[model samples]
Structure formats: C-alpha cells, structure tokens
Target: MNALARRNPWLVVACGAFIVTLAMGVRQSFGLFMRPIGLDIGIGRDMFGLAIAFQNLLFGLVQPFIGALADKHGAGRITAVGALVYAAGLLTAASATSAFGLHLSFGVLIGLAMSATTFVTVLGAVGRVVPAEKRTLAFGLTTAGGSLGQFLVVPAAQGLLSELGWRSALIVMAGVVSLVFVLAAGIAGKPPEAEEEGPPQSLSAALAEASRHRGYWLLNAGFFVCGFHIAFIATHFPAYLTDKGLDAKVGAMSLALVGLFNIFGSYLFGAWGDRWRKNYLLSGIYTARALLIVVFVSLPLGNVTALAFAAGIGFLWLGTVPLTSGLVTGMFGVRYLSMLYGIVFLSHQVGSFFGAWAAGYAYDLTGNYDFAWGASIALGLLAGLVHLPIRDEGLVARPAA
Candidate 1:
C-alpha cells in the first residue's frame, strides 16, 4: 500500500475522501434528528444540543493524541478501529432512550470515532503521499468529500427519518459506515521512508515548537471561529428554518445545498492556496461568513432567501480545512502534520462546543436564535482580522532571537 501510494497518490486521496464522506456525511445528518428525537425522548433542544456540543468537544480534545498514535503507528489501523466504533455509536444512539444515553452514545463514543476517521488522520495520509506543489489542491479535493457527503447524505437521512424513522436511519448509516473498513486498505500503511524530507523532529519537539510560534496560536484562534460558525449552522439551521414556518424538508435541502456548493468552493480555495497566500484567503473566507450572516438575519425570513443563504454559506464552508492544514504543513512539514493539525483542530472543536450548545441555550431562553447569529457575526469578523498578522513563512525562515 505504501508503494502504491508513492506510485499513484491520487488513489490515496480518493480513498481518504471516501472515508471522510462516510464519517462527516453521517455527522452532518445528526441535526435532522434533533427535533424528532427531542419530541420522542421528552427532552428539550438544549439537551440534544448539549449532547452534540459535547461530541464536538470530546472530538477535539482527543485529536492530538489520536494524531500522535496515527503518526506513530499508521492511519489504517486507527481508521479501521474508528469505523467499528462509529458503527457501534450509531447503533447505540438508535437505542438511546434518554439524554444520558444520547450523551454516552453520540457524545463520547462518536466523538472519539470522529477523531480517528475525519480530516486530521485522512489528510495526514494524503499529505505524505501527494507532492508538495499539489498538496493544497489535494487537500481541497479531499475536504470537498465531506461536502459531497453532506450533499448526498443529508437528504437521504431526511428521507430515512421520514420513512423508516431516526433509529432505523442510524442503523442504516452504521451499515454504510462499516464500508470504511474496506477503504482503509487504500490509506493502509505507515509513512514511507522518503516521505519525510528532513531530519526527524521528536513529537515533543514539534509540540514545543508550535507552542512558541505566535502564528500557530493565531491559526488556532481563527479556526475556533470557523468551528463556531459551522457547528451553529449545521446543528441548528434546520430548526431555525422551521421556526420561520418553512417545512422541514427546506431545512434538509438547505444543508444539502451547503454541501453541494462547497464542493466547488473547496476545490477553488485549494487551487488558490497553491498560488496565493493561505492566511489571506482564510481571512477572506471568515469575513465573507460574517457578511453573509448579517445579510441573512437582516432580511425577512422566506424559503428562497433561506436556500440562498445555504448556498452562499456552503460555498464558503470547509474551505478552511485545506488552507489551514496547508499552512501547518508549510511551516512544519508533513512529518508531524497529523499531530500539529490535530492540535489546531482541537481549538476548532472547542469553538464547536460553544456554537452547538449556546445556540440551543439561547433558543430555549429567548425563543429565537438571534443571539447565536449575532455572536457568530462577531466571531467571524474577529477571525478575519486575526489571520492578518500570521506569518506564512516556513519554520526555517524564523529568527532565533
């Protein structure tokens, strides 16, 4: 598998993309379950939202360690184990009869599963295989896989909920997730001997170096905002639309549109990353998110505007993953890409915890999501500004002083 990766890197990218598609695709569908599960289980939106929030939090908390393990062992074994655990989480979620059960299944188990299966581990595999010049584009293409899953799976999930119900839908999803065990074969080996271009840095050395770098923390801060925006929108947008009196299908479609448009956005931004400065591109994406939210909230609620907003936001969505990961690779090299990027992703998930939970809390208190929307705008603008001072230069270029 390692030899095949060297000979044909695109294969590794394709397999990695599929793994993310299954993982994120199912994840993206969870929002659809919120209303139904809340009604059936006698829980409020706050409870459901908290569970999802915890999932994001644990997901981020464990990534650094998971990435380290993947770095030391290999992505294949980690991903395979994650696939089984993800299936178990889904099956367990189906059996959940209370908020505690939901938290145990969806929050703890699935969170850990995501750390193993999603972008951090997958992109690390792709980074080692693809040539440096094409890495950003490859990452973009790979990131697009999650969007593609959103595009394809959210609607399917909605249909399953309507037809077979949430429990059965999750069961079906578990069956789908198990396929990753097979795809794992593609990304199935340790980093090749030639993959690392320099004398090796110890994992502790990598962590210490990142801690001292001002720009690295800045990246973490910016990504935190990104997490907030995505989690708030993905988890609550459907419910928000329903609050506006639109049908539930509109909410599902809106999310699907987000996935659909993001496919192009991910590719374009990735291609752009290879040519232009990544930090500047990141700033633009975040700033655009702020503007989009402002316009979305200011306008009167309607189906057309709702779907349009989904398309607009979706295009800007997930573009951050590639550019941010690219910056880490450029600064530190791919030898520890999984671990460093995992640390950055942990910050993103921390923000996700707030975005998911706070919106629900606000909604429960105020009967509307206005506060969450306002906060998202503020954070987006801050993120846009924060990226400006980041130096995108490689590690060797930094002064010892």
Candidate 2:
C-alpha cells in the first residue's frame, strides 16, 4: 500500500466523501432554485428544465472521457479544472437573463464540471485504495456522504434563498463548491502500485470489452430507470407539492427527507450488495420502487403523505449507485473502472434528460404530473424485469481476491 492508504485509510475515505458531498450537494440544490430562477428571468419551466436536461446530458457524455483521463493521468488536475468550471458556471448562471445563458451556465458548463468531479472519478479513486473485501462498504460510505450533503445543503439553500436573494444564494453556493479543491488535493498522491504492471488499455478497447458482457448491458439499461425516477422526482416534486395547495416549505422538506433517508438506504443496500446477490437485490429495489411510486401517486396530495412518500422513496433513491458500480467492478476488473462505469453513467444521464425535461413538458401541456408519474411506474417495472436476467458473476476472470 502507498503512504496515504497505509497511513490514513479513514482520512482518505473522509476526504473522498467530502469531495462527493460538495459536488452533489450543489447540484441537488439546483432543484430548489428552479421556480425562483424561472420566475425571476421570465423564462418558462421548460426552458429551465431544458438547460438542466442538457446539463445532465453533457455531464453523462463527458464522464467517460473524463474518467479515462483520470485513469490515464490523475484525478487532481481534472478535479481542479472541474471545480473552477463548476464555480464559473454557477456565477454566470446567477447573472443570466436569457435562456441561452442558462443553457450555457447550468447546462454545458456545470454538466461537464460534474462529470469530472462526481461519483465516477471519486469512486474510482476509492476503488483503487480500499481492499476488495471492503470496497462495497467504502462505496456505500462515499454515497452516504453525498446524501448527507443533500440533507444539509437543501435546507441550508432554502434558508439562504429566504434571507438572501436567489442570486446571492448562487454566489454562496459557488463559494461552498470551491472547498472541493482542498479535498481533491488530498487525492493527489501516487496511483496504486499494482497499477504499474503494463500499458493501460485504450478507452475504445475497454469499452468494447465491457460491451461484450451481457451483465454490463443489463446494468446500463437498469440504471436508466434509476436516473429517470430520481430526476423526475427531484426536479418536479416541489412543484407538485405546491400545485396541490401546500406551502413551498413542504416541498423543500420533502426533498430534504429524501436526502436524509437515503443516507441509510444507500448504506444498507450497498452492504447487501457485498454480502448477497447484487442482481437480485437490484431487481428487488426496482420492483419495490415501482410499488412505491404506485402508492405515492395514488394517495391524495398532502403534507403528511408527501413527506412519508419522500422518505420511503428516498431510501431507495441513490441506493442503486453503489450496487451498480460494485457490479461493474465485479464483472470487469477495477483496472478500467472509471471508464467503464462512466459509460454506464452515460445511460443514466440520457434517462435524466428525458425525466427532467419530460416532467416539465408534461406538466406544461397537461397541467398535471400524472403522465410523468405513470411513465416512472412503467420504467421501474421494466427495469426490474431487465435486471433479473443479468449474470452477476465475473465474466472470465476469477473474482478479485
């Protein structure tokens, strides 16, 4: 083991966790700003949703390339550039009055920035440092860090928006994201020594190999549903609550509840992924999500029901992340984890584009989110069925020791 891994494993996990927290925290807060930003700029909800959709699209598109770069070079430079770009995007977004500016700031810039800083990059680093036996738990902890960020930052952003103006809130968030530089710096140590065996595989070859695996495709397809469900709820739930004649704070609290409850949900699922059959567990999660969404949509809109639904759904929310990544590492070796996982994540963002944009589009055309809710249910069931056939064992190589 290298000095950093040997000397301070917990410290490494903490630093990695912090990086994920900052990256995901600010992104999650974007939902809170949708109404204020849209109303202030005279932009339609579709316009804001389109920009966020583009952000998700580009974030997914660039992730594979960024992950490849991190695998080849190091995460430090990529993370530093990502932090700078993310901050600049938020700053520009704060000043924007046009739809084009929103697309540029929130869509392209923030999307690419998040591609560099989020789970693929951070978790790749964690995969390298932590032992194989502990890897799933380590990923679980990192994911929980992101959930904690939502738990804290969403409520904090709400307070800031109430006290300071939305523009000021954006500026404050940009400042908060700057702290990621420090966390990235701590990850700048040498690559794992075991990685020095031979020339790294080209991105094309790595992708080709992953494509040949049935499990990889199944995982990619299943993850699309996860993204669709998360983006739809995250972007639209607040508005949904308000449309039902509840206070805006109720929407915010519902989101916070999702984030808070997910902290435990992700960890529990992740631990189960390590000890049990990951594919079956994933199938169960998707099936359960289908049932949960059915129940949630059926219930009359109210504060109590909404909050309970949020907490219940939130527990299953990002729980897919760690298991999905863990399955990737299990099927393919962690040698090309970043690149392979990035490709899978690309599917996720594609689903996100449709989820975020479609919810807004459906609401605009029909004045009800019923269509989007129905779509989520259908996709959840499809995902559950698709994952059931996945072969979770290692492809050709023996399981990692």
Candidate 3:
C-alpha cells in the first residue's frame, strides 16, 4: 500500500463511504417521497416518475464531462461543489409546487450534483490510493458504505416524513447532507506518489484506445442492464408494494432490506472478485436476479416474501461497482479510470431513465407493475448473455498515428 493508505487506510475508506452514504444512501429514499410529493402537487405518479427519469438521463449525460473534470482537476473541489448543489436541489424540491419546477430541481439539478458526488468520484479516490491487488476489496468496503447508508437512512426518512411532513423533512435532510463537503476534503489532490503509475495518458489517446476495445462496449451493455434493474426497483418498488394493500412501511423496509443485505453481499463479492473471473461473477449475478424476480412475482404478495426479494436483490445490488471498476482498471490502466468508469456509469444511468419511467408508465396504463416486472426479468437474462463473452484482457496499444 502507498504510505498515505498504509498510514490511514480506514480513513480513505471512511471518507469515500461517507460521501456515497450521503449521495446514494439519501437518494434511496426519494422514492418514498414520490407519492406524497405527487399528491401534494396534484400530479400523478407518472409525472413524478418522469422527473426522476430525466434526472437519471441527466446524470448519465454529464458523467463523462464531470469525470474528465475530476481526472484533470482532482475530485476534492468537484465533490464538495456537487454536495452544495445537491443540497440546493433538495431545498428546491422542498419549495417547488409545479411539475416543471420539480423536474428542474429534482431532475436536472440533483442529477448534475449526483454526477460528481456518487461512485465515479468516491471509487476513483479509493482505487487511486490502494494497491492494485487490494483495489477491489477497498471498493467493496466503500461501496458497502453506500449500502449501509441506505439501510439506515430509508427508515429514518420514513419517520421524518411521518413527523415533519415531506417538505420539512427534505429541508432537514438537505442540512444534514451538506456534510459531504467536509467528507470530500479527504480525497483532494492527485494520487499518492508511490501509487502513481508513471505519468498519465493523454485523454485523446486513452479514449481512442478504449473506443477500439470490444470488451469495453460489452461492459457498457451489461452495465446498462444494471442501471435498469436498480432504477426500476429503487424508484418504484415502494409504490408497487403499497399499491398491493401492504402498509407503506413495508415498502420502506423492503428497500432497507436491500441496503442491509447488500453490505455483506458487496464485501463478499469484492473479496471473490480478487480471485475469480469478474465476467463469470457478473453473469451469475444477472442470472440470479432473473430467477429471483420470477420467483418473487410468482409468489403471493406479502411483507415476508417482499423482504426476501429485497434481501436477495440487495445482496446483488451495487456489487457490480467493484467488479465493473476493477474490469476497467484491469483492461485500461488507472490513468483514466474515472472517465472510463463514468462513461460506463452513464450507460447504467441511461437504463435507469427508461426503467424508472417504464414502471410508472406501465402503472398508469395497466394499473399494475406486471409489464415492468416482466421487462426487468427479460433484461436480466439479456445482461447475463452480454457479459458471458467479454474478453477480460488488456488492450494492446496501437501505434499512434
């Protein structure tokens, strides 16, 4: 390990984890607010869904540029700015009463903020300081931090909604979220000297090399499916369960279970990734998800079954982060890991847009989420096929012309 990491390895993980916990963990509960916000504003769930869909789209759209900025300028300033914007967006959401206003704040503003504060920044930091051999393990722990946040924050958000109402709760949450600025201070500056891999690659050359790799695009395709799966469940599952006559708390708890179980799942998968073929692991994950969804949908609807489904799915949740980032670094070198991972993450977010919107649209048209569930199962199978043939090897650099 580099001296910085060796001296305070836990600090690195803690900073990154705490950043994600706030960014991703807090966002997990956004779904819980969908019903209340929609009802208060006289909009349907589909309208709220559209706002969030746009948010996903925006998050993906800006990722590469933001990743480039992080690569060039360091993640410290970028992440802190993102948290401020995120806090502002939340405050905007708290005050907004119209659909367009909601989309502007909830959709565009938060989306931009998320591009900076989430995985690309956090993972890049940990991946930089940690030894090459230990990267995935570090990633798993940091990613689990996000999961842990979800496990704790979702229930707390529900309670806040009950006590303070949605608007007031958002204001309080925004205040708490500002702490990301402080946490982000830890990841500032470039990689440690001992961890540096000679000099950085030119952006254009790196982009050209990655663009030529078939494996890169395959990874993108597989990741797109992951985005779809997460968005569908995270944004809509709460509403789905409640619509079935289960209590609203059941929905919150289900999401919490996903977060809870994923903590272990992420760590275990991270450790396994150091030893196993990442592609095979990804294939298994997708296949398992498909099988679980089929069983969950087939079973009678109840909290126990729902929690079981959540736990099963959650264990697989975000486990993909360490694996996917590891693949990028393994194939392309860490010089531009943030940019490359961000592009792949953009693909994931693209799927997110469609997944979240499709669920709401299906509900609006059919009065149930059957169509969305079926689509999710199909996508899972397709993602498994996509990952099966990825050639996990370094791309040889062609002579520069």
Best by lDDT: 1
Error of 2 at 224 (Å): 0.9
Q: What number of backbone clashes does candidate 3 have, counting pairs of residues 3 or more apart or in separate chains?
A: 0
Residue pairs in collision within model 1: none
Off by over 4 Å in 1: 397-401
All candidates: TM-score: 0.98, 0.96, 0.96
Using lDDT as the measure, name the better of candidate 1 and candidate 3.
1
Whole-model lDDT values for every prediction: 0.93, 0.85, 0.88
* Ordered list by lDDT, greatest first: 1, 3, 2
lDDT of 2 by residue, 74-121 (tens): 676788789999999999998999889999999999999999888988
State the lDDT at 60 in candidate 2: 93
Question: lDDT of model 3 at residue 385?
Answer: 92
Question: How would you encode candidate 3's per-residue C-alpha lDDT over 1-401 as one tens digit per residue?
Answer: 33555578677778889899888888899999989998898998788989899999999999988888877677877899999999999999999999998899889999999999988977877777777778888889889988998999999999999999999999988987899999888877655434445444678978998899898999999999999999999999999988899999999999999999999988988888889998889989998999999999999999899999999999999899889988887877766778989999999999999888889988999999999999889999999998888865766542211
Residue-level error in angstroms, candidate 2, position 256: 0.8
Ordering by TM-score: 1, 2, 3
Q: Please give the lDDT score at residue 24 for candidate 1.
A: 95
Residue-wise lDDT of candidate 1 within 39-113, one digit each (tens)? 999999999999999999999999999998888778998999999999999999999999999999889999999
Instruction: Compute the lDDT of residue 325 as modeled in candidate 1.
Output: 98
